[model samples]
Target: MPRPPARPRLTILDVARDAGVSKTSVSRYFGPERSLLSESMRTRIEASISRLGFYPDRIASSLRGRRTGLIGMLVADMRNPFTVAMIHGAEQACRARGYSLVVCNTDSDDLLEQRHLDVLQGYNVEGLVVNTRGHSVAPLVARFEAGLPMVMVDRHLPGLACDMVGLDNAQAMHLAMTHLAEQGYRKVLMVTPPIPGISSREERTACFESEALLSGLESELFEVDLDNEPARLGERLAGWLDEAPACRGAILTGNGVVNLAVCQALHQLMPAPLERTGLLGIDELEWCALVGPGISTVEQPVGAMGEEAIIRLLTRIEGDAEAPVHRTFEATLNVRGSTARVD
Candidate 1:
């Protein structure tokens, strides 16, 4: 078979000629050393590039010691609404700052987390955003020691002086306990998923205990497997209702996932349950309002935390040399009939 001749790869010069502009202008449009070019000029260059189907030679540029304009993000799980909102916020920030984002989802798997970190570093990513469980994060520790510009979401790595941006768990716990106490909830039962290597979960648990004692409320916490008998949670809730007087007990959930699990478990009890016991959650769900009497919650600023993490990473990448920082976003409390005391 005869081989056809190959088409030459399009160059920036071709784009410049097509747009009736200089090669330097086209270069400026593509480079990380951003300069303010007129909007009309930018529009013309964009149209010409689109029409010619031009793709820049990023490999060649990187070889010449130029910035790649690439940032990497590591997410523990994509199914959670928190991860989704954070990713969306980061994508928006990257676009606004004229950079590209590469997201890696590890699903809380240690091996996959290591592999993704290696791959992100191999591509010479300018900075990283980590939201992993910190189980098998030794590779991450090495990178941090090597002085990579990085930020951890919701927590700092174990004993590593790293920057972190997340919801204020302590503040949230205080708020939740206070609200529940105000509603005459003398006892609280918080049900959560497995908690071990994740610092955020641990911190919330501690805060819940301390806040309960401080607020003069008795509290009980249960750790359960979501995959196994979810109905067990309902049994626990039933016990709570039986132990405390009517309108004197409440259920406080760990996060959105736990909130849903507890809701499903409590559903079988039906009619009297919602009105009898108070209910509140840490992470706000979109369906909270649609539920019966609406579920109360302490809503974390997911999007803001994501945006701030990127902002902090960018600062480090731009050579801001200072001690590690901790940025915590506030959570808002949404009160509903679910928390109202029946006199």
Candidate 2:
């Protein structure tokens, strides 16, 4: 069989000729200065573009001394609901500002994060929002020094100073721990993934420990492997339940992943551990409500966080040159059956 003929690539000149307008007018209609064209001209250009199927080449426009109008986002783990929410919020904000977004997922790999950063830089994105495992900051710092506007979302580079937008993790910990305490959970166990270099997890774990002390609640921290070792987590939980004081204990998860792991472990236990111990988590999930005796959570303003990160990056890109601004959003507590007090 013969291959189909290639579609003709339309151009601005064709649209201008078809619309009976000057090339400048067509350019203005396609560029950011569309208001310069008269109403009739605008209508004619729109109709002509529709008829000709002409699409403006953003790359060519960038090459001609125009902004690429693209924002890049690097997410450590795309599967996380929080990252998805952040991307959604950032995309909306970028669209509203007449810019597009290019997202790169690192899958929690340091090498992948470095490569994604290089690729995004090659594209000359107007700005970047980074939510990644900040194990290495040298590359990021080099880019920032070279005048790349950036905002760190939910995690911060250790030595580099940049706009950071995320949940007030300390406040989130306080909310979760205090709620558990109010529910008569005297012994609290905080479960998290490894805290090697991620700032958010470390901050949350520290906050949990400090707040637990202040609240007079006996607390212990547990680090779980992300390789889906539910059996190990369950064994630890079972041991904690057997050793710790009776029905007065609860499990607090550092984030959504840990939350799911903890919940799964509890489900496998014989007596349905939810009936005996309180469970609460940070970063709410869609299934939180559907599970038996819904899981309580401190819901981060993920969408707002993402939007704020973009707004801050845009500001920096627009030449806001003051000290880096760090914005921390407050989390909302949603109480449910899992954290209910047991008499």
Candidate 3:
């Protein structure tokens, strides 16, 4: 059978032939000079390429090509609504700039993050915006050292040295704590998500603790693993409710869903939840109003962060800046019925 004639190595020439266009036209159609083609012709070429699964030879193209005009976004957790919002923001900005975005979810794993980075790099993405979960920054440092364009989104490493775009987590947590303190809640308990040396969470939690200490307010920490048994979080909170102080206490939860778990546990543990304890949720909850007492929350400007990340990446890719640029936006504390003044 002659191995099916070696399967006729599919190339741009074959794609152009199948699409009824010159190979050079197809090449130019997919090139950085996209404005040279009409919308209809560009759409046709894209459709043809999609149908043929024709991947351009980046290695050979790189020798002579100017740019891939692509950007990669790496999210540590796609399920988190905040991350989703940020990505949506990035997608909008990327499209507006005539650059396509390739998104990868690492699920908060270093190995997975590294693998995605390698694959994206291999595909010759023009730049990267990453929300990393790992502490081992050697690989990323190597890439940045080799002059690959990169920007950190929502996560920071101490010495890895890269541009960062993130919410001001410390200031955000401090704002939440101050809100509770201002409401005259003597005892406050912060419900935190799992801290595995992830920069954002650690900074926010540390700031909350230190702020509470500085304010001379009584506070304690409780951690729940968000990756595992997210639903079972209610059960853990129920146990805390049983042992917590009876005197009017305010609880500050780290994430939106975690706030629901706390609310659920509060409902089960107390005949009247609000009278027993106050709640101030971190990150806005969709069902905050639907639930009784309407949870208060700190809303991170997730979309803004995403927009900033992509903008910084694009600027780097376009040779606007060679040095790292870091931007931190403060979170807004939205007061609600769940945690009111004690007067």
Candidate 4:
């Protein structure tokens, strides 16, 4: 084999020389104090870094200071569209602030969640964004009490009292219920996953139950077992549809997962005609438009929620000692053919 040329070892010195600035200026450019530098100097340093492809060692930089420039995100289910969108927003915010994100998926498992927490802590991440399964809270509470900067996304941990960024569950349920009622859906069936420990699920379910009565729409709740016999979802859905008064019934899903399951059941029970039965869901999906009659959805501001979570976590990390804030963003309703009234 022919000998290959070795790549040049680039460093701060290289960047400084290339940018015609002192090493201190280059270092400050990468640090939080980059704002202290003139815009011209900052631009030159950025250009120099790009030209030389000189990547700073984050670990080495952390050794010189307390910040590791790493943010940790613990997600309950990475496969969910909402979670994926949130991660994208958080990652963008982190990068814009010159930080990196480390994400761990718990798969809705308590033990796995604890294990991921330990790993994130071991890596000394500057802050954490938790979208937990709400099954276990001991580890999370300990970390929060230990002065670790943390924010909860979508789901809340009992007794932890941390900042949370998520959708307004009450408003979301109200929107769904009101839409169904307006479309002349007098009877509603709300489908969701188990609602034992998850706060979001519980809140949405409770809201639906309470608001349904207030909206003057009779409502029934169904907890689908996604892991066990998912096919039974179709059976239960069929039963509900069969029992509901024709042209006066509708189905509302709690979240994206429930939406997917309900969608599956609807597909299996096709040719039954959805014109008489309306459908609406929280957390919009990409294929909602392609589905039968274009499934109606309450489009959550997922990206904004994620960005806000990062900003809040960073605030805590930067020594904001104020009381915990529970920020909830509103969801927008996207009406489509699914929720249209049948003649």
Candidate 5:
């Protein structure tokens, strides 16, 4: 199939000619000085605009030092429900504030993240909401130091002093550990994706380990590549079960993605692994309750967190000179069949 011919670009001069008015009149009609135009002249411009279907070019307007009313977001992975929910919250907040959000999903690719930063910069976005791996923080730091307003969600970069909104990691871990221990589980394994530069996972894993120690439970932390290491996870899980045959063991996932990966590995390793080992996760998913015996989760207020990120970003954009603030939201425990004691 061939592409359709491109239509000629409409210009302000065209609207002025069609309305039988000067280009300055058309400009004033769209500007704050629109009130100065006579009713008859305004009516003529309106009619011409309706007939021509002329939509003002925002980029051209922005080039003249007008605000684009745009906010940019860079996401680490769009596949995760957490990211999607956060994006939803940010988008709603943006709409409510008369600002447009431009989301660029990095797809967990470091190179794309770098490129997206440049693209968002070129557009002169008023602010940014970032949720991604912090391995390459130099660009973000440079931008932040250069006076670009920013807020981080779920993960905070180590050195960048930017506003951050996230769940209280210590409290969340205490909740997860307490529930498992109360359920009569003596041994727990913490599962997560690679946790080097991602601060959220790092905090969750650390807190889980600390909580396990304080609770006097035997614990081990493991990282798995969900894309290619389910079989390895199965092996580790099978070995873990054998390591403590008499005691009931549970798997504590660091986030929603890890929860899914753990389930996949368990299903492949045995007939029904949830019955053998308790399952709990740090993040909640819509389908969590639908799985066999329903997966329990520590639900983070992702939507609210996302909204708070936008709120904080807007404050910065609006000339809030206070220091970068960090806010942590409380997480709740949702008990389900997966975490129950089978015996």
Candidate 6:
């Protein structure tokens, strides 16, 4: 005689029924706010859940739910290799903890960033790791203040406080500037993104300027919007080079994107019998070391930064968002042929 069909596998409701408690009580028992039930009741519910092999329907619960194991990452520009590497780090961390990541690109637009953030909230992501473009982040900050977890990477927002992981911008510049000076470069040009609002660029510019002044070396700044017109960089660089003819010196750039512009400018503006100009850049690029004169650089620990951002974001997700922490990895000054000593 065949045994009666096995009873349907137990679920949360079955566990609740066996434990003689409401489903809500069983949920409260397993959740953080565990004061709603007695120890005896909690134990009974736990035993029933274990014995019955019952698992909470996390997805459905998140639909009307509390704490979905999902995270949202907002990047200002997805094209940047540094940002892409950071995303890789975040993905590794998230996967390890059985969480999922949703990435959105805001293209440095405040409105787009806000819209993407709103969509994340609608999906009930447990946390957010953001690389905002310094737009209106007050609402996001307010949510963070009201207990939603957030961690910022790469760029810092003005007047908004959040846990952040990034490189020490000033230190990177100081190292690059000192390296250039040691190579006997008296006049230096710094190619950079727009300053004032862009924190990373601003910090780099400030440090370069201050260090140059301190060392009594004449330094010039050439700013460009690489994203808007990458090819137009040549024109801007040419103008800068034409104006500063005395500086047959090296050029230091803030990032890879700006470095491209600097190189293009050099290629276009230099008169026949091209002057041997030096080049240094922050944030290493794939082709940087391969080019002629091989770009000298202050290499940021991109992998480490990515890992740290995820680690910090997860920590905050686990109820540690209140205590603000800032971790900045030092940049390594890599001397290549670009900044070679002039005979």
TM-score of 3: 0.79
Per-residue CA lDDT of model 5 for 1-343, tens digit only, reads: 9999999989989999999999999877765356678889989999999999997775777799976678999998998989999999989887766577899999888899999999998988878999988878999999999999999999889778999999999999999998888888898988889988888888888888899999888998889887766677778888865654467888888889878877877777777667678889878898899989899999999999989999999889889989889999999999999888645
lDDT, residue 257, candidate 6 = 71
The TM-scores of all predictions, comma-separated, are 0.93, 0.89, 0.79, 0.91, 0.84, 0.78
Higher-lDDT candidate of 4 and 6: 4
All models: lDDT?
0.85, 0.86, 0.79, 0.86, 0.87, 0.77
- Residue 139 of model 6 has an lDDT of 80
Please name the candidate that would achieve the greatest lDDT relative to the true structure. 5
- The TM-score of candidate 5 is 0.84
Error of 6 at 26 (Å): 18
Q: Give me the runs in candidate 6 sitting further than 4 Å from their true place.
A: 1-58, 64-66, 228-232, 239-248, 268-275
Question: What is the Cα-based TM-score of model 2?
Answer: 0.89
Reference-based TM-score, model 6 = 0.78
Segments of candidate 3 deviating more than 4 angstroms: 1-64, 228-236, 242-245, 268-272
Each candidate's number of clashing pairs is 0, 0, 0, 0, 0, 1
- Pairs of residues clashing in candidate 3: none
* Candidate 6 residue-wise lDDT, 100-216, digit = tens: 689999988888988898898877778888886776768887777777778888877765677888889877877887887787878787877878777777777888999998766
Best by TM-score: 1
Q: For candidate 4, lDDT tens digit of each residue in 69-182?
A: 789999988998999999999999887776789999999888999999999987888889999787788888998899888899987888898999988989988888888888
List residue ranges in candidate 2 displaced over 4 A: 1-9, 16-48, 228-230, 243-247
